[model samples]
Target: MTRSPTQTGRRAFLAGGAALLATPALAQTTNYTTPFENSTVVERDPSEVVRRNISSFRSLDWRPYFSDTRNGAVLVDTTSRALHFWSGDQSVYKLYPTSVPLTEELTRLGRTEIVRKVVGPEWRPTPSMKERNPEWPDYVGPGPDNPLGTHALYLSWTYYRIHGTHDTRKIGRKSSNGCIGLYNEHIAELFGLTNVGTQVLLI
Candidate 1:
């Protein structure tokens, strides 16, 4: 059967993820982030600050990743902070710079699936999450500064989401509290294509 765009993305991601798994001998298994400059993987703590400025930011973007429409299923490797939308032959990848919680909770739930999608997602901050530094802006409008922009794909693994960030400058670097962030248009497009049962390779 001819696979859909999302399906193509999922296959490509799985292929890459499989290769990533098998190439432990060839590929560098111990990847490090400047965000974790002085920290140890074993010492990851959500409370521990691994990235800076992300403590408070002004704008976010999602237009880049959603440049094209999704086919059917997509592969999003959170550990690598990359999103892959596979089209049968060629594949598109977008890197999202985010700081994951340096904690067992996140590590233990790595490489999981992305179950659902949302557009112009609403925000609901936890009391504790809000207490941790408290600079996260209250619900804001989409485009250039909205924390949750045009779309947000929710991960069933945890309350975390692969969402569009108002802060696009942070892409390709570590800077989230354990969520996959994207830019407005990018995620908006992905959200439109993504559906239930779509695979999300967290890495």
Candidate 2:
């Protein structure tokens, strides 16, 4: 049978659409590599992993979260998995992705101030962390292996910090024990901008 070119093209397009409709959608997978030495890589389905970047990552006003940007103000929005920083003079502002605590039980929400800032920060597993994972190292000096990365801002609350992570994958995920984690570069910049006595609020 002879068919017009237009008829042939229409048939071909319908066939392609049918093929696409028959194919199942592939689930997205992510490979997570732990920072610990000799740790095995694990593949996780999107649903299995902690939700990240789910909330709006837009710039926020400091007035809503802080009374004033005195000595600089840092606001960690656990729901959004983001960190917002406003300079003391309100000249410099930054927004960065962050990793929050693993679970609600580990999460602390309230006001705290930066009591100290350390470069090349050493790390020691908290007593509770040690009890939970005895296999973890007793101490890790400042280096690539150090989970605290290159810099750390110690908060007034004990065992809590706003620090950098050697594991980049941890950022924008709920992967920390009881701290907020940022990319090393972001933390270095933040470290330089902030100082002791910077007001921090985690909400």
Candidate 3:
């Protein structure tokens, strides 16, 4: 019987331990722009930021220890601010930079499954988020400035999402309020490939 990508990827994760791969420099370039491409609130170039941080972006083949039996899990590493998707093949995995909330709670760290996928997602700041920042809007319509970017992969666990960001500079950094953030373009591509019921492991 052929092993599923989930099975192989899970096995890798269990056996590989938590040692993450080194992020290599990215040589690719694109005409990237902030998610706020249409907004005039603040104009800034994102391609330049990407050029500066290019050295910190990377995607690696998931090691055997990072494998998943489901063959369709989205593995996230808070320490590295990186997310991986096992392509049902041990030799192939897609990687993207991400931002995870900075915390030290072991119980908060674990695996969950993707329960839904939202395109052009709206933003409703949580009570906790509002409390921390009183000026936060009650709701933000989907657009360039929306924190959820163009797509959001809603996790089974409440109050968390693998979504897009307006700030490209935050990628590969531990700078979220307890959610995973990806670049708008990156999340758009990821959303197309991901599906509901995909496993999400945050370690």
| Best of the candidates, TM-score | 2
By summed lDDT, the worst window of 10 consecutive residues in model 2 runs over 23-32
Error of 3 at 176 (Å): 0.8
All candidates' TM-scores? 0.50, 0.77, 0.67
Show where candidate 1 strays beyond 4 Å. 1-72, 87-108, 135-145
lDDT for 81 (candidate 2):
82
lDDT of 2 by residue, 1-203 (tens): 99999999999987876554332111112222323432112223322334344437667888998888889999999987888888888878888888788789989999999999999999998898878787888888989998898999999999999998877666666678889988888899899999999999999
lDDT of 3 by residue, 1-203 (tens): 99999999988875543223223222122321322332112113322222223433455444533455354667786766677776443333567777667455312468787899999898887787778667677888898778788899998888888998886555665456778888888788778767787777787
Q: Superpose all Cα atoms of candidate 3 onto the true structure and report the RMSD in Å to 1 decimal.
A: 15.4
* Candidate lDDT (C-alpha), each: 0.50, 0.79, 0.65
True-vs-predicted CA distance for residue 184, candidate 2, Å = 0.2
Question: By the TM-score metric, which is better: model 1 or model 3?
Answer: 3
* Model 1 lDDT-worst window of ten: 23-32
Considering every candidate listed, which one attains the maximal lDDT?
2
